[model samples]
Target: VQDNLEGALTEADIEPLNMPEMDRDELVEGESFKFTLLCQVKPDIELKGLDALTVNRELVEVGDTEINAEIEGLREQNAELEPVEDRGSETGDIVTFDFVGTLDGEEEPFDGGSGTEHPLELGSGQFIEGFEDQLIGVKEGDERVVDVTFPEDYQAEHLAAKLAHFACTVKSVRCKALADVDDEFAVDLGHDDLSALRASVYDRLFEAATKEKDGDVREQLLKGLMEANEIEIPAALIEMAQKQLQNQMGMHLAMNGMPRDQIAQAMESETEGVLERAKEMAHRDLLLDAAAVEGDISVSDDELEERIGEIAVDMNQPKAKVRASLQENDRIHSVRGEMLHEKTLRWLEEQASSVSGDSTSASAEGNPTADDASDSNVEVADEES
Candidate 1:
């Protein structure tokens, strides 16, 4: 309908207000028919007095303390685990075991409550609260009946708040041996030496801090603009925005170990937050589009070629090949849109009084730190990845 209406009515953009029902029963067979479409154009926004808006873009400080912490994290990641055969299992040890669980007083083991030779880090909270504590003193080949009560909000409907016992045996206990932070450690991680590694980490950290500050500035600009010019969001967009956000939050919870069966209930509990976020998304999109028009932000052929040339360099492919691939995948417009969006945001950032960002316009030629894969940038790599 958007394309057809745009062609018929000569309108550039059209947003449908509602999905109207059509009457087809009265049309005769082989007879010519005509239909009219009624679409509500989404509001075109005007960004006025943006130059007077004051949004603080505090520059994040990158200190030696932060650098040291990041380096320490790398050291921890490179640590090796060594078996401790002489002692019984203790906190911080990785223990391997087998176990079967039954309801506190039941005669038989319960379903989905047994494991053999599973390795679990003691005190990691990977299991029920009391389960790991019981393994703390158990030696290899030792057996103990461990008791624990499931949490009230446990995902399993039948097992929530229930007590269970596991007859277990320990196979081994191991402790981590942290690497020494030295030139050798840096060399092992493919860096020339400790100094070189620190320099690289520093550069990376500074870049990250800059990007974070830039994002904060953009957010404040949009928030101030939206507050100044409020519009009621249509129902269709509200439903769409709410569902996408709800699913995203639910997926995050699931990835962090929440069971799927309870995600629906958890999402239901977050109805208000989801609605507000949905409204914010819709509002930001509207304002950005309006700002794009108001500022006349566009991606000229030369600017697009410049961005694609950079993309080709990043992808290690020739510019011609990369452009061909993008065109083949129907992603040329998406790339253009991303560039346009960035240009629009850069325009808004220019209006701010205090911002920690590059003075160069987004389309300007330079080693732009913008690998900004717009919402569309996500799709270009789908088939290839």
Candidate 2:
């Protein structure tokens, strides 16, 4: 039924609310047949999508401070840990310890409050505030009681704002022996010299800044599109969209090693704003399609292939294999649709104006993009449900 609906109405974004009113058995080949479907469709409205949008683009300025920071990070990465024998432990020293955290007056440690052979850097804030402070002067093989209070809004509700005592055994202490920075340092990092490394770092940072600016523009344009257009979506469509969202989330979590039962339990416990998110996703897709039509944006075959080629490169796969996978999953059209959506955004970015102050473009109501949004007749077999 979905395939047929998409085949007949490519950009209609219609969701059928009921079975079609026509009997499939009664239809004859090569003859005109009409069926009625109670469809709740996307409304066509003028979008302020590609207009005098005001966005901000920060100047990509890379100073010596930033370059030196990057170089320091590289130095830290190349540094080795040297065992500390003279001093106990300092703010920047790495301490290996075993700890069992117990709430005040409790005998046994609370769940998830104990660890053995934990390596932590003092002042790194890996542990609670006072916990690290108390570990500051601890030497190897030392035993001490560290006291700290969890934050009021701690993630574990049971432990929030509770004063806990950690029985700690200091195992070892180490400090970073930072690598020397010189002409040889640049060669070690695959650069000709320190100057070349600085230049490369600046170029990388500038490119990242450019992408971030483009992202901001796209976000602002989408905001303008949503604000300038008001489309009434039906409840059935929202329900369908919510299911798709849940499935997508489930797939993502499963891919990340989350147990299916746990995922279901988590989702069940946190469904408050899922409907709103689904509605927003649906609304965004509809508005993007309308913007594409307004911009006359079309994705050519070669363009789609080239985009896939880029994806192939990024994923380290053959272009043909990627194309085949997308085809097998019937996501090729979705890729094209995304391309159209991106093209529309790029066009809007081109038309946007950058200013120092925060400004938003306004749009006026105009003619609908298609025929008046009405309940179109559609036909489906009862068994199809």
lDDT of 1 by residue, 1-385 (tens): 4445547654644446456433334566897666666445566556665767668867466555566678878865777778887777778778898999999879898878999999998998999998899888777788899999999987676789999999998777777776666667779999876666666666677778778877888888887888787887666767767887987898899998776767777788789988988988878777777888988788899999999999999999999999999999888987997788789998997777874444222212212122321111111111100
Query: What's the lDDT of the predicted structure labeled candidate 2?
Result: 0.73
Error of 1 at 46 (Å): 2.9
Cα distance off (Å), candidate 1, residue 33: 9.0
TM-score of model number 1 = 0.74
Which candidate wins on lDDT? 1
Q: Give TM-scores for every candidate, taking all chains together and pairing residue i with residue i.
A: 0.74, 0.74
**Candidate-wise lDDT, in order:** 0.75, 0.73
Please identify model 1 stretches exceeding 4 Å from their true place: 1-6, 9-36, 105-112, 246-272, 300-339, 355-385
